[model samples]
Target: MVTVQAKLIFEGSEDKQRVLDLMRRWSSCMRYAYKRLLEGHKRNELKKQLQGIFNLNSRYVDDAIMKAKSILTSCKERGENPKKVVFGGRQLFEKLQKRHINGKAYKKLQLKWQEKRKGNLYSRGDRSKKGNLNTRIEIDEDCTRLRINVGEREYVYARIQPGWKIKDGRYIDRNQLLEAISICGQPYSVQLKLKSGVVYAYFAIEEVFPQPAITRANGVIGIDTNAYPRHVAWVETDEHGQLLGYGRIPMPELESGSFEKKEYYRWQYAHMIVQMAKEKQKAIVIESLSIKDRGRREDFSGRRSRRIRHYFGYRSLLEKVKLLAKREGIEVIEVNPAYTSVIGMLKYAPQFMVSKDVASSYVIARRGLGLRDRIPHNYMMFLGRLDVNELEELKEYVRKVVKNTYVRKKQLREIGRVIKFLQSLESEAERLSVPLDGTSTGSRGKNHNLWQVLKVAVVTPLSPERVLRDLSVLKSLLVSGQVGKTYKGASSCFLGQGLWLSQIPPAGAGKA
Candidate 1:
């Protein structure tokens, strides 16, 4: 897919006015469509409503509904609240409330806000319609002519010409647009954006480019995206999943910087990763985490909410890498991210002597190669040695905290979740203890999340508070699997009344 931005040349001021009027009407229909769509109205139903409410043809009405539906879908993907969304900038809306301001400045701001509300138009291409039914473009001698259907038979023509865009003191040439539009009868979606009476056209055409000859059968490069101590940990693995090389792509720009700087660095880092994969003739592996599944803003508050919206651009970077990889003909693999960090920290970090993130990439790389992780004998024995009865005592200790502690409602809820999670872990542990005499696979879950059980089992001993974060602790359990006699009472940090008392390693571990 390739998109080019060009300036739409108008023959007269009347033509510009006509486009602006269409944009205003389109925006009005779009808002109505959004309202109806939110009320669970179907696209066909909303289309009928738009045609009756606004002065537009069938194509314009469908486009408005399509655009509105896309916006709603994106909001869902980003976990944004549709109800709290302000059409214009929220800052601009608040500025209108200020009385101590210049009249002209106030009017300019007002105009800008109104423009956002009613200055957008779009139309999807139709191959059967000889390109687009609305913004129809065709070759005209040396240049191309764009014919816009303004009314039920009336039309306006504009010449497609290359334009220059200045950004951060750099001028970007648009000559590629002319080259792209040189071919005729190709379907191209067009979006016209109005700014101070000027119409800028964005032409996007999607085409299936040939896949690169290089393939994933060679090897894989696994990437672990990190926020704090911002950097992307990457590992190059052989086709058999053995680690060959490793490095980190520094991304401090994500920690604190302007949106432009962040965007620039995102591409910079994405290009570097794509180049590495290309040079190694390997496929790229990354987590397939959904943006909407990350967390909702309503579930958190203050800095936590801000972090959900503003923290590391995981989705953005992931998308950038995918785009660049596609263009370079490098294969990109997406693996389930469940417990990759936990498995890495507990199993690979100490064994490989690397940071948690790098270890995570290693696990990811191996997963891409269809390699499965088995629980080490040490941790499995640890679980097998666990006195399942002691978990009940731990729950009792937590119930007392919820009843007597003065923590916030949210914290209490979190503690409740922890208790429930512990109960589930306890059930699994009892199963593990039952098969202490065999090395058969019946000790625990093959259907259940083996890594999740290990996560809870190992994390409880080491930072019991931040169990979910896996904050770089318990990374030494794999170094010397034969070590023993390490035990701590489940009090203090555990917040328990020393109820979780037992031998961490089973006394008869060798027997098992």
Candidate 2:
């Protein structure tokens, strides 16, 4: 099933005003339903309450309650502390925004609020100004126009364009009203939204057909999603796990400054993935990543801003891809992500001449194929002798080093400065030479503090070789410019123009 938007044209100012009034009423109904739900009222009871409180049709009241319940349920499922539902507030009427317009207008105040590029929550319309009406609106018998029954024997007829062809063959017109939206199969519900002054009707087209059940596939495409420098590294492999190809799809919205664009691009990217899977006739494999608590961690607090940009939709990609895949008759599989990245980096990256993420994607594909398990022999041996605490300590040290070197370096200049700082810190420590005190003091024994500033001190067991390797990784990251180059005075950022392909090495080449 697919849903498309069919915009409606309101001919007169009064017609537009009437639709706006309907939207306001709808918002009020949603607010009422939400409050009742918070007070422990059941959905059916809330519907009954709305029928008495509002003069809208019974179907409209029921739809309003249903919308509110969906919002409340979604919030609870996400483990969020649902606050008092407010119309035109920061939460943006999660229910009201999506209430059944039933071929009516929906205020685009929230969308405009987002367009300002300001922070979330902006006022577009007052609760008193917006009204909502669901029923009494129907497409004319000829399907060439809409007949909206505003009152007894009183109807507002809006003429609409039949259809307009877009550049990509997708029909969308914000200015012209659409008369009839050619749909495939049967359209179950037609929803309308009025924002600003334009009206858009959404048609939920439901098509039933005999779907062929897919047998076991011989290959799968594995996708590894990264938040920072957002992208999905995908690799295709045979059933036996031998890699056939690899690539990466950069997602610019992960870092896009606009919340609206972030949402739009997220779905756009998901659709692309689903289309790719459909074209290839292969199943999709992805990690069941859960980063709900990522922002709460102290280590992640520094990136809170960037994280917030995409966090709400971090899991949305998976859900969307799965949904589209199901509709397309494509199978999607999830596999354990533990150690896939580690093994991919250490064992497959050099062999395949790909990035760690790409290599991890390869491993993920193979794991989904049930062809790979157990760490390599040497890795297992090393793991056998390492104590749990020692391993954790080493992991922590590496984490701090990488975090300081890569994440912190963004505050300063290129890798050269980083290497210089590490070397100078080492020199300062050597000059002190007397088992420096608990902490190393700077030039004035206080000012230009290296330890505090760098978030790392010249502790023992550090080496130039290690710093060099870290510098090398930092240099590669800087060169790649994973976030993409930014342009001033531009609304959209150029994303992922570069393409990566596996460069299989010679037969006798050294394979790490």
Candidate 3:
């Protein structure tokens, strides 16, 4: 059977005082029962049974009494009348049954007590002269609205205007009623009512329904998140782990010297990447960064630092991404970012060096770099050994290959251009004493740079002849000093954006 539910709101301080007094009296009754049992009274058998009941009932009485005393004390401390108290009779009864005694006799005893105190129980004092108890209590579907009865030969039941049916069958909390003086605190799932200019609402106590599950697909996408161009890298993979296509989209530039703008763009980029994932029918895999207790330095300092700490809202963005992915039936997975930039570079190194000839070579090379291996360091160390050299000639050659990788080169150019432009704009703005538009300032000029870079990186050599040719190009670029410091800036950008990209897609993909 469906449970019947209703909510009652107190009218004034007198009503509250009455309820508190009742709870205190109830506590006193339990104490008296215990004393009688200890004293070996004539009702010794009854007292013995009541001792068990009193022990169980003491908790409820203590809780109710404490709440009542708290309200009255607060009113007294503030020099206000203690006339209104709100308590759930049904909830109190249920608690008693669950915690104290349950059976026909206990039920009868409860009914008898309520019947005996029908009028004076909640309306005993002068403050209740309006006679609200006789009229105001209300019952409605899912306990959304309340009805009140006020005196003066008039009914004063408070009624909440009906709205949408309560979703997920939850009830409001009693504390919510005591705290909510305005409608803003009302439960979104249920409507509320107010009497004497005070509002009270209730939310369902039941657990919410689980979110719908999403179906799985064979398509997979590797998302490399970055700052200047939020969704910096995207690679589509087929069922057999073949790279079908890959691309990167540059994000709008965030105004320099504006941390808030930077954070806002972070969220925007994350959202756009999630959207892109949905559109492409691909599952997303992202690098996970531990935001809490990760010992990361704050981007801002002083009061600005405090504001960034309090308002950056990365947690909220993560929640949004998860929700969006859930709704769209796309899968999102997180991988450790500890060495992603380095690993990705190594995997795609050959393609960038020879442009078109080494594409297939990198694909085969990357197949062995998966972090899922039981021994990640062993694998990484192996890759490191391939390019490690103390000799200047060999060292330069390896560095060139790593730098020439399609993603690395493109990322380096993007960062250099963006930083240069931002620094230049900052200098100009300082001179002019003007601020640039926060959303309009970044390295979005190279629209096709990401795709071009990937295309250059993915071209594999079909034969050994091509591999040798690509290796020669790698050696030349390294020795000639054509590539500068391995672009660490892009790695930093990816770290920042990775947090935003990790939560995408609605379903879990099969093990990679």
- Go through the candidates in order and give each one's C-alpha lDDT: 0.70, 0.52, 0.38
Candidate that would win on TM-score: 1
Cα RMSD to the true fold for all candidates? 6.9, 16.0, 21.4
Q: What are the models' TM-scores?
A: 0.70, 0.54, 0.35
Best model number under lDDT: 1
Query: What tens digits encode model 2's per-residue C-alpha lDDT throughout 1-512?
Result: 44444556778889866655555566578767788888898876667667666666565666677767887888889897767434445555453456673243344545544322221110111123221222212445654555554444456766654365331223455223222323212224445564554666554434453353431275788888866557888987766677888899987656646655566666778888878877777788888775433343335565764455345466877777777677777777888876676556545664566787887888788778876543333222222222334334433444544555543333223222323333443342243232222123454333232222222211111332242112222222122322223354443332211111012112223437
Q: Please give the ranking of all candidate structures by TM-score, highest first, separated by commas.
A: 1, 2, 3
Worst 10 residues of 3 by lDDT: 499-508
Model 1 per-residue lDDT tens digits across residues 292-409: 3233334445465357447578888888888888877888889998778877877887777787889999999988888888777666555544454655454454455444433223
Model 3 residue runs over 4 Å out of place are 1-143, 146-216, 224-234, 245-275, 291-313, 349-512
Number of clashes in every candidate structure?
Answer: 0, 15, 42
lDDT of 1: 0.70
Q: What residue runs in model 1 are displaced by over 4 Å at the alpha carbon?
A: 24-58, 61-110, 137-145, 151-155, 159-172, 182-185, 212-214, 291-298, 302-311, 388-481, 484-512
Q: What tens digits encode model 3's per-residue C-alpha lDDT throughout 1-512? A: 11122344455666544433433344444344334433444443443454355332333333323334454558669986544322334454555566466688677656544432231212111122321222232344444333322223434333443233321122345334322322322221222323233333333222223343322255556655443222356666664556677666564444243655555565566667677767766666554545432112433344644444344444444455555565566666655544344324333443344222123222322232342312122221221122112122222332355554543444445333433333443342242232221122235433322222222322221111123233333322223312212343343211122211122111222224
Clashing pairs in 1: none
**Number of clashes in model 2?**
15
